[model samples]
Target: MSTDSMERTLERTRRRFIRRQRTQRWLRWRAILAVAVALLLVAGAVWTVFFSSLLAVQAVDVEGTSLLSPAQVRSAAAITPGDPLARVDLARIEGRLMALAPVKDVEVTREWPDRILIVVSERVAVAAVPVGSGFKGIDADGVLFRDFAAQPKNLPLIVLPDDIGQDAMKEGADVIAALPTELQARIDHVEVESVDGISLVLDDEKVVVWGSAERSADKARVLDALLNAAPRASTYDVSAPGQPTTSD
Candidate 1:
């Protein structure tokens, strides 16, 4: 090719390359600017969340405190006004409140915007038992709830040994269910020696002994015969099923 023609072609190619580079630079700048703006917006959103007035607890709604006072529960929850409701650790709050003697269960939940709610079910005693200090009416789970000198509620008394555990409570319920209607009504208190051995102290001060958790239905039926035998007895042994023996 001629020298003049080759030089002209080289200059035109150089101009086109420079223009393309500028265009590429402008596009790159636009992309960088967009990314920076997005990052700024995300940072602002986080800041707003961390410092928003909505996080403060404006009110507290407490429910399920029939036996316990709402004010008392609120105090126990430690969720007062001006606290950070959004940052409230529910697990911690529930744990703290559950330590109360009267509380069986406790729950805490957020009420959105600026509120906190707490719900609690106080323990109800089904029977009284002797603990360290004195006799206390305990719940079905064998948890000590209320003190009882003679009788707290109209519920039947449960006489358990000092070594009795939660299993004894379950054994008591089972024995109560197996007893006859008439005999069950007359039963004022149930004394369990162990899961393997149980006794019923009737209102008439008679002791009905149950041998074990096995053959419960047969043992309960024979108890009626032993009670009606017209012979004053010290212990009615229902452990032997049909052949119940009494010891005076």
Candidate 2:
């Protein structure tokens, strides 16, 4: 081969090598750029799920509170501000709220990205029992929750022995609750001897033998009929509602 032909062949080989190098460098940079972009996208998703302010709790909404103020319910929940709403433990917050004496039921939930909602149902007092010089309020479910300096006027007084168990107190409360509103308003107090033995005394000192909590609706009906028939009875017995008796 001539020298000029050899030089031209060498020049063609050098150009081909340079082209290959440029292509490899471009591919390597593209791969690195793709990896960096993927890492950035994953990091952004993680921050949104676990650390972003847009997804953090900004407000706590409380509802169904009467006896307990909103502040009291919020204090019981104890959820920290700016915590991730998706990661909030609803069951833990509900358990905390239930620890309050008057709370009957509670529901906790997350409201989208920025809020948590708490709903509470509080127990209501149906009767009052003497505790030393003051009184303790008892709900219809027989939970003695509140202590008052004075006896509340509308609620009936519960009279049970000092050694009386919760079952007997619940029985007496059930008896009072079964009565009609008019009859309930007339009740001055309730007496419990045992779970199966319950009684009611009216405001005028008229006595009723209500027996156990069972068959209460029947007893209430019979007692209402008996009282209406004999308006001035001093004693009413409806333990056997089918054969009720009234006596002076």
Candidate 3:
């Protein structure tokens, strides 16, 4: 081969190698630039969420509140305004709200941007018990929650001895809960002397002897049948549900 031909071929190979190196360098820098941009974007987002005022708490919204007012719930939550919403401890807020007497359960959540939401489940009153001149509400779990200046007309009165234990109150609550709705409406008060001694007093002053919480459904059924068969009877005994009796 001629020397000029060989030189031209070598020059073409060297130029090709230089072009390849340039392309590879450009690609490496492009990837680094992309990674740097992504990191900056992530850092900016973190700053906005954790330090900037744009995502700070400005309001606290309370929902699912009936027994407690919104202000009451917010007070219990104790979330400070202007704090970063992303930094709010939802579990701690929930624990604080659960300390309230009427609050059965609560959920705390971030509503994004500027608000915190607190959803509460309040205890429902199943009965009332005398306390001083007022009455205290009792839930189905026999937990005393709220107080009323006077006895609530809709809830049955639970008459328990001053020294009665929680078990007696629970038994009385169970007996009331087991009664059919029709019979429940007729109830005026529940007399609980002990866990095993529970009775229902109807509006007409008639007594339904319900011995204990055991077999409460059976007792309720038997009492319903007895009332239908002899509506005018004064005393209905269904403690032993299999053998019910009624006396005038």
Candidate 4:
């Protein structure tokens, strides 16, 4: 081949190589730009959820608050307005509301957009004890939660021994809760010296020897039959329900 022709072919090859290098560099820069753009979009989405006011809380709705007012629950929750809904601490809110004595269970939830909902369950009282000028009500779990100036209806007075331990209190409350409504209404008070020594005093001055919370349903059925058969009995013993007795 002639020297000039060979030089021209070499020159064409050099030009093609330079063009390929430029194309590879352009593709690498384009890929880096795309990754940077994706990272920025993800950061923006996170900021919107955690810090932006678009999803901030504006109202609090409370449900199942028969014993506690809505205002009381909201105050206990201590949720700040204008905070992002995703940033609210639900477990912390539940803990604060459950600290109240009457609250047995609580659920805190985020209602979409601009609201928080709190639902609560309060304990029910089955017995009462005099404290100062008021009566402190105790539930079946022996938790003293309610306070009233006068005796609450349908709740029996607690006459357990002085310094009665928690076991006696729990047993006495359970016994009182197990009585039928008709019999419970006729009872004036309950006395408990020990877990096994639970007794009920009727409004008519009749005495009921209730032994323990065990077999309470059987005892109640036996007592009902005895009271119906001997309505004038002064004392009724149902401790051994299978063999009940009455005394004049």
Candidate 5:
């Protein structure tokens, strides 16, 4: 080929390569600019949310608790509507609610856009244990809740073991429910010597040696039979099956 023709061909090839590289560079710049714009838009939206309005609790919802008023439960949760959801911690709210004496358990869930829901489980009073001036209401699991305003007339008074404290108060309640209604009525108070044994002091001053928690219902039945066969003020000892002993 001629030198002039060869030089012209090389120049054309170089020009084409430069044009293609420019197009590619332009495409990369455009993509980067578009991503930057999108990120700025997201940042603006987030900033508006955090600063445009006063961050305060706006609304609160409570569930799973009937005994406590919504206001009470919400107060316990220490959360409200209008509060910045970002700073609103569900764990801290749940912890505060659970700290209340009446609340047994609590769960906090965030309903996005502006709402907080607090679900709660209140302690269930299983029975009452006599204390000074009033009776301590024990929950289903034997945890002591609160003292009644006045002595509960219909509620059975349980005598808990000294070590039972507030937690084991429920055990005494379970034993009370295990006893037969007829035998339960003749009793003034039940004595718990360790959750292991339960003794009943009847109106007639007779002692029921109901040793251990085993066969409590059956043992109570035996006491009923003995009472029917005997008179008031009779001591009916039922520590053993088929060996009920009565004393004057």
Candidate 6:
């Protein structure tokens, strides 16, 4: 080959190599810049969620509260405004609300940018127990929650012995819960002597011998049928539900 031709070919090859090197260097810098930008975005998001006031708590909303007021729920939650929402302890807030007697279950959650939500499930009273001058409300679970100035007409009175155990109170509550709605409305009070000796006194002075909490559903069904069949009966024995008896 001629020297001039060889020199021209060599110059072209050198220029091509320089261009490729420049392109490769630019591609590597682009990747590095992309990764850096992504890292900066992640760091900024973390700061906003964990430390910045932009995502801090501004309000606490309460839901499913009936026995307790919204103010009571908020006070129990004790979440401070301006605290980072993402950093708020939901489990801790729930624990605090559960400490209240009327609260059966509670769930605390963050409502995004700046709000907290506390949902409470309050206990429903099934019976009222005479306590001093007032009456204490007992739920179906036998948990004593609130107090009434006087016995609520809607709830049946529960007469438990002074030394009655929780089991007896729970048994009485269970018996009342098992009764049909129609029969429950006729109930005046329940006398619980022991776990196995629970009785229901109807509004008309009729007595229902409900032996124990066991097989209460069966007993409730039998008693309902007996009441319909012998409407004039004064006492009903449904301890053995399969063979119930009624006496006037």
Question: Among these predicted structures, which one has the highest TM-score?
Answer: 6
Q: Sort the candidates on lDDT, descending order.
A: 6, 3, 4, 2, 1, 5
Off by over 4 Å in 5: 1-8, 34-56, 160-164, 177-187, 202-206, 211-248
Better of 2 and 3 by TM-score: 3
Order of candidates by TM-score, top first? 6, 3, 4, 2, 5, 1
lDDT of each: 0.77, 0.89, 0.91, 0.91, 0.74, 0.92
Report how far off residue 205 is in candidate 1 (Å). Answer: 2.3
TM-score (C-alpha, index-matched) for candidate 4 = 0.83
Top model number, lDDT: 6
Cα lDDT of model 5 by residue, 23-135, tens digit: 99999999999999999999987775664444344778788877778988877777645667667888888878877777888888867666787888888765578777777
Model 6, 1-248: lDDT tens digits are 99999999999999999999999999999999999999999999999999999999999999999889999899878889999999999988888999999999998888997999888899999889998899999998888999899999888899988899888889989988877788889888999999999988999999999899899888888888898999999999998888899999
The model with the greater lDDT, 2 or 3, is: 3
Q: Decide which is better by TM-score, 1 or 5.
A: 5
User: Where is model 4 more than 4 Å wrong at Cα?
Assistant: 1-23
- Score residue 42 of candidate 5 by CA lDDT: 93
lDDT of 4 by residue, 60-139 (tens): 99999888899999999999999999999999999999899999899999999889999899999988977778898888
Candidate 3 least-lDDT 10 residues: 173-182
At residue 229, give the lDDT of candidate 6.
98
* TM-score of decoy 6: 0.89
Q: Summarize candidate 3's per-residue lDDT along 1-248 as a digit string, tens digits.
A: 99999999999999999999999999999999999999999999999999999999999999999889999999888999999999999999999999999999988889987999888999998899998899999987778899999999888899988898988888888887777788889999999999889999999999988999999988888888898899999999988999998999
lDDT of 1 at 21: 100
Q: Please identify model 2 stretches exceeding 4 Å from their true place.
A: 1-43, 230-233
Q: Cα miss at 180, model 3 (Å)?
A: 2.9
* lDDT for each residue of candidate 2 in 175-237, tens digit (9 for 90 to 100): 877778998888888888999888899998999998888899999889889889998899999
RMSD of 5: 4.1
Following a full C-alpha superposition, what root-mean-square deviation does model 4 have from the true structure?
2.9
Error of 6 at 160 (Å): 1.6
